[model samples]
Target: MALEDIPRLGCGRSIDRIWGTIDRPPTAHEEQCDQCQTARTRLRRLSKATRSLRESDLHNPTMEPRPGIKNAIMDVVRAKVRRGSRILLRSADNGTTEISEQALSSLIRSAAAAIPGVHSRRCRIEIRSAAASVADEDHPTGTTGTSTNAGPRLIINLRVAAAPGIVIPRTVEALRHEISNAIPASVGIGAGTVNITVEDLYDV
Candidate 1:
């Protein structure tokens, strides 16, 4: 049954009860209640259908999205990628600063994509738990400069697709140079290792 067809307060309780009971043992009343059981069955089926549709949309967008669907779809994609591992960019008297691995990866990809023949792929940023030391630059003294006071050091892993006939070493070096200049200045964190993997090659 479509969600709208299910009465909002059916089964002698609000739909919240159905939501609250998902993936857990149902209460005594719910176990014997026909309406609640039926709703749960329908909802589970609906959930599976939703997943199938999402997979289809992801793999089969061969043509331009219709009307305003492109932006809507992109918004959903961005929201899904927004959260991941986090880093302490800096700390101060009042509070601490932080950024997600997603943000850091985006920065790295932007740098890599700016190069002539590199297509950015998956990127990851990790903090070495054992590498935390006092960064010199964290201060509340009204300085506009980025904190030299350190946070945990980062390890970056980047995968890219190289275009045919490009100088691979030179391209990777350029990505490294760009990343080195961009990451620290953008977020007051230091990097320990940047592992670049040339995972694929494609025609230009």
Candidate 2:
């Protein structure tokens, strides 16, 4: 698993710390902290899954996901659920539209993965306070999925892994362009900047 994908608790400690304690007694701190104990329980289930996968002969023709990858991704999604981190699609006199971060993340990831030779790793959307963005003065709400630029201008950051031997610069540029166009269309708001980081090169 990529080190960056490690799941961290709300206290900022990685869950790997919990996994490390599998063979030994829990520390005094861990024993006292309910958060660590709860995370440990979840990690134990994941540990069982990892052990099972290690014993299996199955292998993906492309690349198999590393152990704990799903757990780590689920942690982020659960965090969003707890915090209710959401984006305002658009604000109009009629009403305001909003989407949860988890939903938007899914949409953005799907869009990125659609690009050939690339696989999306992470996507983050930052909302910026801005002037009202209405499609037209007459029909402020606009048509379905046509707010164009809705409530707030957004700054989007993306990290993707490209297949080895691909033209990194050209592919990333296409990714950036695609995201800039897709986000506004998918949601009501527009992305002011789409920042792409080709963080990893994976075997084809």
Candidate 3:
């Protein structure tokens, strides 16, 4: 029978049965059968290659990510939080007195410049605002009173250039803490968050 007409071999078959009753090399009939010859050659090559690869050493014996990877991931998360907390500020009196993104950025620059041990050239600030409304609780009339709300809350992100001799962790913490405190004190609205990024070190 042609190879195609013969029943296909199953895994449960005996080794002798799988090799097909022939004790010798492929016979004229088997060799002449193109389909059987191709299958035999493929199975032989696969078996040899698998055996050789099983004995090979291809995996690293000791390889791992650097210890700083965790810190890097944390830094990225802090950056995202800072960006998310951004707020835009505007004056209530005139829409013309609006705080453009560029203006807010300039304000951040000015603020950072005023701080000692910081490089204004390498500093950046981003701000965003959200409206807040609250019922007036201290009205003399004691009625519902005129419900009032502050315009919006501002969130700022600052990246300051650090000098070579500065203690990076302490400097970053101090900058963030100070900026957060200063913005609310000056602008009359609470600063939601302040993120400080140190991008590069300056010699000065």
Candidate 4:
């Protein structure tokens, strides 16, 4: 498989392995796979960029995300979850308004982005309906499918780069709190579970 097979061949576990978060060794298939190698190279580049960002932050503690960063993130989210459907929110007139998964994801991303020393990178949202037994297993940036149903519960998963010198647990807690609060206000739906993962560490 080549790089184009990423959606089919490579998933989040491959990324976890690249980040050293996964302890297991790669299988023979993965070790000999061209797609995995390509993914590794790209992921390594991303890791290096985060390190460069850390160095820059050490020199400038007050630095902020550059212009268009949020837009770039949104672009990536949209491309990843284009197959997903929109969510329906209750309105005062006994009507329902549709909120795209991408929009809800933006809210979650914004919540994390507001925190100092945190750079929100990826946000995945799953909406589970009462008729369904479980939430959708598909992750947007990962090799999983996404689903949408009306009046479903929302589960948000966010990946961020935490700056050095910041408390990890506290930072994650802050993201969860802010994201939970932002959901109902923005889309009129209660957030179910807010999962935060610190994928990389940068400088403050």
User: Could you say which candidate leads in lDDT?
Assistant: 2
**Per-residue lDDT of 43-142 in model 3, one digit per residue for the tens?**
6776668767765634534444576577567545545554443343445655523334344445556566666677643234433334232331355765
lDDT scores for all predictions?
A: 0.73, 0.74, 0.54, 0.72
Off by over 4 Å in 2: 1-83, 92-94, 132-150
Q: Choose the strongest candidate by TM-score.
A: 1
Clashing pairs in 1: 135-149, 135-150, 136-149, 137-148, 137-149
The sequence of per-residue lDDT tens digits that candidate 1 reaches over residues 121-175 is 7676767642343233364676654535346767788888999899999999988
Off by over 4 Å in 4: 1-84, 91-95, 131-150
Q: Model 1: residues >4 Å from true position, as ranges?
A: 1-84, 130-149
* lDDT, candidate 4, at 165: 89
Query: Rank by lDDT, descending?
Result: 2, 1, 4, 3
Per-prediction TM-score: 0.55, 0.54, 0.39, 0.52
Give lDDT: candidate 3, residue 86. Answer: 35
190: Cα error in model 4, Å: 0.6
Whole-model lDDT, candidate 1? 0.73
Residue-wise C-alpha lDDT for candidate 2, range 1-204, written one tens digit per residue: 555787788777777777887657888877888888898878788888898877673664446678659957875865566347777765689997888776777777778877899988777777665543333234535455344343676677888888998899998888788777777788756667788898988787
State which candidate, 1 or 2, has the greater lDDT: 2
Clash count for each candidate, listed in order shown: 5, 1, 6, 2
